[model samples]
Target: MEFLGIWIAAFLTLCIYSFLYRDNPFYRFAEHLLVGMSVGYIIILTIYFGLIPYAWDPIQKAVTGEASRWGFLTLIPICIGLLFFTRLSTRHAWLIRYPIAILMGVTSGIMIPNALQTDIFAQVQGTLNPFSVIGTLSSFEIFGAILIVIGVICTLTYFFFSVEHRGPIAGISKVGITFLMIGFGSAFGNTVMGRVALLIQRVDFLINDWIGTIF
Candidate 1:
């Protein structure tokens, strides 16, 4: 069984890597199989790990008088979940909006404060430093901080559509564009590095584990 699994994995890996040469049926088959398996596994996990443990068990306990009234509250989410199935019916598809709205409202209510704190407050706090650090900051640190502050101001100014980009505004906007380019380049480099790392891992696995087993 283990050897069979290893051969299957190796075959699938080769199938996927075939895409590097050109698009082929082997790659497409592997990709579709992976996606279908992922979706099926997720559905199974949701039924067993999520619905069964949280909703089904609680409702069963409530019905059996093994749990308190609190257990009955689990039925609320179960009903909401059932509403998703209504989407299969053309006439009842509109009902899906209720669950979607409930989810959106709850998620937005939960995430708004967190987003403000992390994206806004935390960033502002990070960008600002006390002048008291004058003695602690090296010349390089001071220069870097000034550059960051300038970059931020220029970037913000670039977004100001009220004034036309002329003279000083043009110069500032150019600086802003430079900073944006640098940020984008860094992000692309990181993405490439991540993919390279994944490729390296797969190659290592094929060389050390999979092929070694055969030998």
Candidate 2:
């Protein structure tokens, strides 16, 4: 069974890789299979771990007097969730907007403060305290911290469009542009490296596990 599983995985891996040559039925089959399996797995998890445990079980417990009567309140959100299916019917599609608006309002309310705290305030705090390492850290560490401070300032300056881009502001913004390019290049390189790592793993599996098993 282990060998059978390995062989199946190897075949699917090759099927996906075959897309490098050209599109074909094998690649399509593998793609669809992966998507179908992923969706099926998510649905199962949602039913067992989410809906049954949180919604149905609570309602059952409430009925049996095993839990608080407030468990019936779960029906409100369940009905709201059911509203999402209204999108499939042209006449009742407008009802979906209510749930969507509620979702957006709640999500934004929850996320706005967290975003401000983590993204804006945290970044400002970090940038402001770059020199905090000066007394305790090595020169290289201090230089790195200074570099980070400079990068953050310049990057922020580049996005500032209030004043015209001339003279010192222009020069700093140009430095910001350079920093942006370097950041983007590093990100691209990292992504390429990740893909290369996956390729290496697949190739290693094909050569070692599949071929070695056959031999």
Each candidate's clash count? 0, 0
lDDT, candidates in the order shown:
0.90, 0.93
lDDT of 2 by residue, 50-166 (tens): 989988998999999999999999899989988999999999999999899999999999999999999999988887675765688788988888888889889999999999989
lDDT of 1 at 126: 71
Tens-digit lDDT track of model 1 for 48-119: 999899888998998999988689998788898789999999999999998999999999999999999999
TM-score of each: 0.88, 0.88
Candidate 2 segments exceeding 4 Å error = 137-140, 161-168
Residue clash pairs of candidate 1: none
Would you give me the overall lDDT of model 2?
0.93
